[model samples]
Target: MPSPLVVLSHLRWDFVYQRPQHVLSRLAATRPVFVVEEPVHADGSPRLEAIDAALGVTVLRPHTPVGEPGFSDAQLDVVAPLVRRWAVETEALGACDAWVYTPLATPLLDAVEPRAVVYDCMDELSAFDHAPAGLLDRERDLLGRADLVFTGGPSLYRAKKDRHSSVHCFPSSVDAAHFGQARPGAPALDEPADQRDLAHPRLGFFGVIDERLDRDVVAALAAAHPEWQVVMVGPVVKIDPAELPQAPNLHWLGGKTYDELPAYLAGWDVCLLPFARNRSTEFISPTKTLEYFAAERPVVSTPITDVADPYGDIVRLADTPAAFVGACEAALDAGDADRQRRTEAMRAVLARTSWDATAAAMGRLLDAASRAPSAHPPTPTHSSTPARATSTL
Candidate 1:
């Protein structure tokens, strides 16, 4: 039997089905996967709420009296004992692997004697708005303990490479068939009610609206094109929703499930990535870039380092609202030949990677670690190349 995978994550399993959910769900097909979410404040004593989230995955939501929900020291103090007890009761500690997504979760490592420890650094959390205190110190602790470290993008890999002995870049990947349902002439999907009434030439974006999003660009886009609708999906987080720029053409329909995203994408004429070039967005590799590509929609993005370096060839990069508007106009006015050329380019990009290939590569590393003599194995020679992942459409 495969080793049980115990995951400590800042993201909730049911929340946006991004990196952790995508990779773990694929990993769960072979291993028993248990995800311990950041704590939720409750009046009562600390406890665990286990929900069978998928075929081989169990999501453990910790309820603590502490106000903070992230993996802070206080939260670790409350969650460690609780999770240890749960692991003991469930007999999941034996021959298990601890997969960590946040540095603050390092304290929880004392709860288990796993075959190996994996730090899957998906984001530069310390730079995010309202990040907890002592995050950098905790990240140092996690990096020291982690047997292997996986960065979500090339930019992140560069930032973390020198800090850890073993670091690998696994950039965001796409689910072509899933998002391809949005392509023209594909099976008709039900239009979401919130977006159904919105007028066309829709320029859409889906993902958490936080400090990273350039609100001015969004407002400017809507203001410049009264005939065109700017539809922003996903939950508003960290930043105050009241602070968001308002306009007649702008509509925030809020978050939708992973299954419902394609329906919304199908109706969009152009996809957007209007990220602020701030500390919070320095290392981000927006997954929506590939998702939009899979939908065969023309994409316009701020020149985020990760997105620009690898995808500037295919995606339109615009920083100013006027340039953004111009790019969108170009996208909307493109002839069939241009669209087809972009579609073919996107397909070539999508063909290079997938979550399945990523998980498998990770599994190989885990297996190697399990077979090694020490919990932390000797570092393999560092390479600039990203993990070689191949997938079939």
Candidate 2:
């Protein structure tokens, strides 16, 4: 019989940004899946209704809110009880053969006594200012105990390989069929008034407007090409919109639902990812890169390692402001023949790298973990262990 799987993550189904749901939705075909998430939104009240509908997985969110920014005491208050409850619940769910913990909830792994533990390190949490102190230590403990580990990008995999015997790079992937359907005449979301009036060729980008974005590069490009309207869609995280060096040509249309993304991408002449060189941005395998290609839109991105690989053939890479502006112009000016060739190349790549494919890889890792010896090879329990830190995603 196939082993049952349980997924532990900070995010519940309703949270639109979580990538684990995408993978989980794909994995539901092979096994019974259960998700344990933050309790505050436990009654299926979170925006994950679509995900729940798609994945057919049981979700359990605790009634107590655990961690939050700027409140160490509150975080601990929530986590301690949450951990105890999780332990009790996992013990009750006797058929669970494996546990897959996303980074945020890995700390709770100590409570669950699963046959195999898999750590899905999808992002470098330590780099984010909001991440809790001693997070790195918890990650180190988790990695040390994890029977298998998976990273979200090549750079992340390289950075973590030495720490674990079994580490694999599984970058963000897309539901190609969903994105590829954004062809001409597809219905689009109600365009923001500011963006609605803007003249085409619409140069666009979608995703969080966070500290990783190179504002200088975006500003330079917007200013240099006043005729080309730049439309940025997504939530602003870790960065204030007022701090951005905005030009009249730049329009910031705040966060849209995931279902609306393809419609926006379909109308774009070129897609841009102008990220700064920072710890948070370094190992990121932006899911937008694949979505852009799936929509058949050409892409321009910063020289981030993960972004430069795989999609490099279809994307223009730029380091400096001038290079970025030049690349965008070049991408826009490329002949139909070149564009078609690049599009075909990207389609082939996307076919091989998809969320379904990624979930299969993860499934195999869990299968292996189930067969391997437990890492808990009888270490003496310490009353209090000093925090040890490690990287993630």
Candidate 3:
């Protein structure tokens, strides 16, 4: 039997399915995979609870009492023991690898003397809104301790590659076959009632409507082109709804399931990546960038570095709202010949990049590092996962 794999993530297992869900689910088939989440206070005091999240992976959550909540100081002290107990039991069985998404999980390195420690830097968390205090320090510490470091994008790799002994850039990858359902001839499910009867030439943007979203840009673009219906999908977080710009052409569809996306995407004439050019967004490699290309939708985005640097030739890029609206107009006016040309070019790119390959590469790196000469001595060789993983929740 293979050794156990423990993943400490800042994101809840049920939160938007991104890199973590895709990679870890596949690794679970051969290794005992446990995705541990920050404490949840459904009741009082902290206890570790594990739920089977399919693919033989377990999602463990630390539940603390509302009064003694959070993973800081005394609270962390309480939560640490419960976590340590679970980790010790798992490690006792065999060698263990601790894969972490957040630098804040640096404390976990002590709880589990993992044979291998992988720091998957999926985002520049220090720059996000309401980021925890002293996060940079923790990240620096994590960088020092990590046996293998994986950055989410090129820009991030450039920023961090020098800081670590070994670092690999694994940009946001895609599940092309699923998003390919948006293409013609794929069976489109019943369109959502609200969007079914809506006007044509729908300009759509989906994903978390958060601080990274340029709401003003969206409003301005919608108002400038009222004939084009601008539909924004996904949950609004960390910002007040009242703060969002309003226009007759703008519509908020809230969040949708992974299954529902292809249908909505199928109806969209153009996809919008209205991301703000701020610290919070500088290094974010939008997962949807590849997804939009996979759907064969014409895309117009602000100067998102990761999106522009790679896909600028394939997708349109403009900074100001006026320029963004103009780009959208150009995309809308694109002839079939022009759209087909872009589609073929993009298809070649998507065919090479996928969540499966990324997961396999990550697995190889972790497995090699686990047996490498290090502080924690090696055991038997670890097993390789059969495939890349994906998940609904």
**Number of the candidate with higher lDDT, 1 or 3:** 1
Candidate 2 segments whose C-alpha is farther than 4 A from its true place? 38-54, 65-77, 80-92, 97-104, 184-195, 371-393
Give each model a TM-score. Answer: 0.95, 0.83, 0.92
Sort the predicted structures by lDDT, highest score first.
1, 3, 2
Q: Give the Cα error of residue 34 in candidate 3, in Å.
A: 0.5
Model 2, range 224-297, lDDT digits (tens) per residue?
Answer: 99998898888887777789878888888888878877767777788899999888887787877778777878
Report every candidate's CA lDDT.
Answer: 0.86, 0.70, 0.80
Cα displacement (Å) at residue 231, model 3: 1.3
lDDT of predicted model 1: 0.86
Candidate numbers, best TM-score first, in rank order: 1, 3, 2
Off by over 4 Å in 3: 66-70, 90-93, 373-393
Error of 1 at 10 (Å): 0.7
Compose the digit string of candidate 1's lDDT tens values, residues 1-393: 668889989889888989888888888988899998999999899899999999889999999999966887777888999988987888655778889998888888788667788999889998887888888998999888888888888888889888877887877677788999999889999999999999888999999989999998998899888999999999998889999999888999898999999999999999999999999999998888889988989999999998888777778899888898899999999999988888888877777777788788887777677667285455643323322222232
